[model samples]
Target chain A: MLKINNLSATVDDGNKTILEALSLEVPAGEVHAIMGPNGAGKSTLSYVLTGRDGYDVTSGDVTLDGDDLLEMDPEERAAKGMFLSFQYPLEIPGVPTMTFLKTALNAQRRARGEEEMAAPEFLKKARALAKELKMKPEMLKRPLNVGFSGGEKKRMEIFQMMMLEPRFILMDETDSGLDVDALRIVADGVNKLRSPDRGMLIITHYQRLLDYIVPDRVHVLSGGKIAASGDADFAKKLEAEGYDAYAA
Target chain B: MTHMPLKLENLPTRRDEAWKWTDVRGRVSETSAGLSVAGLPKFTLPDGITVSEVETDDLDTDSAMAKLARNFGGKVWAVSVPEGFSSDTPLIIEGLNRGHIRIRIDIAKGASLSVIEHHAGDAGGFVNVDMTVTLKAEAKFDRTIVHNDPADCVRIATAHITAWNDAAVTQHALSFGGALSRIETRLAGMGKHIEATLNGAYLLDDKRHCDMTSYIDLAVPDCTIRQAVKGVVTDKSRGVFQGKFHVRRPAQHTDAEMRHDALMLSDTSEIRSKPELEIYADDVACAHGNTIGQLDESALFYMRQRGIPLAEARALLTEAFVADVFDDLDDEDLRESLLGKIREWLKEG
Candidate 1:
């Protein structure tokens, strides 16, 4: 379970406050979707939760399983079962995808006081997962996200999320660049990871993505605050009518 | 053999444009005051290769260092590869505590040879090495030079190579800088249709200094050349790369590219590069690029976000930055060994 109480954050070293005393909570065994228009601080919320630099949290408390998440480093937050699917995945040249994945998995395990996975076991798991995701084996050998298509990049991000199996997942605008087929495949990957012990907060601008994953609750974010909360029908109504009335 | 006193004043100084970033004169004066010759280390040649000790009288007198190496009273060890002979085994020549050495390698027509020269010594002293490599028509030669000397020692080496018609020559050099280490290479392409590649890299930390200066001449028609040099400097270390390519008027269809990239891990670290092209030919493809920068911050953040610690992320990026230069080596074990050395060096910082 993840809880954010009165979470307010700023950009440019607190010059601009993007999130104004925003509060939200997604309990375990639930999927929450935050539907907001452009500049509604959806991405900022994800970054602040993940402890990325350049985002100053003005005042807020973010706890995961009753543990304060704000006091940890980015990697520490990651090891504590937090995963963020970036809106724009980074291209890390010279590091093969397989190597990066293995390192991430092992590093997280090590941080959690678990034994490192052997090479053969890691390879087998990676190969099987990659094949299921329709990714070529050679793609795993290339540099991470370098020269990959937009669809391929999104698929790779989901592949990593599936492999790491974090306790709390933040899908930041995961539906922005994906086509219908890619959206379906990515949604399927996310759907398969759904469980009673894991919580997911999906952020998107449109309601089309909700049809695939079918969130349990939908929160409309406007003016850096949750303006409304409703069930799955709220997403369809907002998509059909738009967020103009909800704008501040 | 008589021991000649080195004239420090005659050495190249920083006032010279070519040696501006490298204070060879000052370093030599400070370290070569009480330098003495140690016992020459013996060399064992691989099978099918012949070795002979020759006189150093025929060496070129282009610079003070070359002249010093020629007149230093050290016997020139020459290795010859007969015509049409090819072998995968590499001949290794090591300079362990040897004061001065002159090496000459001659490959006859259509022969192939590979050589690895390692310069290392634990005792604090001066090392001078001069080598001449001649490749006859249709010959192929590959050479790898590794310089890992003592922290207190000063090493100066020069290699002059000549490639005849249709000959292919490749040279790779890696230097973990010492108090002052310099490797200078001069390559000349004679006759037509020759291919040559000059690759070098340096990893330096602390107050160490390493300079790689090269001059390649494309004299005949249809010769191709490539030069890629990379460096990683941390702490207060300094690295320098000066490369020049000259395409003569007769070399009509020449193609050459030179690139030098460096990563400065610390603010105090320094990397200076100068890539020059002199073209007299109307039809040639010549390009040069140089960049000196720190690691990509976003890339670092991305790696860290994936759970890799800061130090590990930095080491990974640094290794990736210098990995391409070693990708051309044919020996997998040697390549991995060199990469492992690089990784170890990165961890030390």
Candidate 2:
């Protein structure tokens, strides 16, 4: 479970307050969706929670499974079972996907005081996961997202989420720019990887992604903080109604 | 032997066939002839892999061939690659005169060898370092040459690799130094199947110039050659890469790929790449690519978003850009050393 308390952050240097004293928590065994209109800081909130830089933490405390997530390094946060599927992931050429996945997974394993997985074991698990996700085998050979299309990039992020088996994941608009079929495939991959001990925060701009990976709670964000919170039905109402009233 | 005179005729300079772009004739001080090699630093690798020298001018003075013997006179180094030689022992051969340093390596057919020739001296100095690698048919040679010498330094390092049937030669050259440094590599592949990869990385700063001109000759069948050169230039520094993969008619089923990618860190920095493939036969899959530009701003923004400071991000990207050249280097110790030097350079740049 992830706990966030009194989070207020600003886009560094500028007096721009992206998150104005927002606070929310996602309990274990549940999916929390954050939806908002343009410039509502939905992505900023996700970034802030993940401890991404640029957003100066005006005042905040974020904890994962009772451990302070804000104080940890990016890799350390990752080792503690936290994942973020970025809206625009990096394209690392010449560094194969398998190498990246193995490095990240091994780093986590090392942090947890576990024996490093051998190359053979790593390959076996990766191949099996790719097959379940319907990922092309050739993808594992290429550089991480080097020449991947938009849909493939999203799919690769979910694939990492599955492979790492993160205890908590922040999907920052993982559905953006994806076609319906591609979105369905990605959502299915995320759905299959979900577990009772894991929690997720799916950040999105549209209501369509909520249909596949239904959230237990839907929060409407406006001006950085949560403006409205409700059950799954709130998503349908917003889809039919739009966030015009929330902005007001 | 050519006398070590202050004014020697036909001095090798920028006008020579090998050193056309870098002229070092008017640079060397007259006091250089007396400069002692005794004070040169020595490096001891972690393992007991100590480097010893052998002289050929004592044994076969007349039998010495071409440039190796002409400048080499009687000096030759027969480096003994200890059995199961697997450490990252980078043999350093710095502080050289216009004379040559020819090292003949006997890497037992299946053995692995990583030879790193590092150059560092005064500006306007002409140094020729030649290394002959004969992989007895099945040996693996991961050779690397790092040239971080002073600007106006003219350097011609020739590496002749003969990978007899089924041998692999992963040849890497990092030329971050030199006013005009060029690495020319000539490889003969396939006594069976040789995997010859020729890669170069240069970081140009303050009008420094570099060139990696190589020729890969695939005389036999089933040989694969992959050549990639990446550079980062600042100020008015220039980077040039001219690579040619000649696949003869007898060399069938050859797979050769040559890629040149460079990043200009400053507005005045320039890069010129010509990747040529001259194939006399049709049964080969060969491709060449050249990309010259700056770092991707989006990637920079992304890394900055992750809280890695901008300077650190640039260093990391620069490292990652050139790190591919050493990805296949068989020696772990040598790889780490090269990476360390590159990281240091990135920090300052």
Scored by TM-score, the top model is 1
Model 2, A1-248: lDDT tens digits are: 79888888889565898887788999999999999898999888867766665768888888999999888766567778778889989897655788667766776787778888899988998898888777899999998898899888888888888877888889998988789888888888888877899999998888899999999999998878889999988999988998989883
Clashes of each: 0, 8
RMSD of each: 1.7, 8.5
* Residue A112 displacement in candidate 1 (angstroms): 0.8
Error of 2 at B282 (Å): 23
Per residue, candidate 1 scores C-alpha lDDT tens digits across B60-116 of 657766677766636778889999989878888874454667778899999999888
Each candidate: chain B TM-score: 0.95, 0.79
- Report the alpha-carbon TM-score of model 1 versus the true structure: 0.97
Off by over 4 Å in 2: A177-185, B1-4, B8-98, B101-126, B129-155, B158-181, B184-199, B202-228, B232-260, B263-349
In model 2, pairs of residues that clash are: B14-B22, B14-B23, B57-B74, B88-B334, B109-B139, B165-B191, B165-B192, B166-B193
Q: Find the candidate with the highest lDDT and give its number.
A: 1
In model 2, the Cα lDDT at residue A154 comes to 85
Q: What is the TM-score of chain B in candidate 1?
A: 0.95
lDDT of 1 by residue, A115-156 (tens): 999999989988888888888999999999999988888899
lDDT of model 1 at residue B12?
A: 73
DockQ for every model, please.
0.76, 0.10
Task: Please tell me how candidate 1 rates in CAPRI terms.
Answer: medium
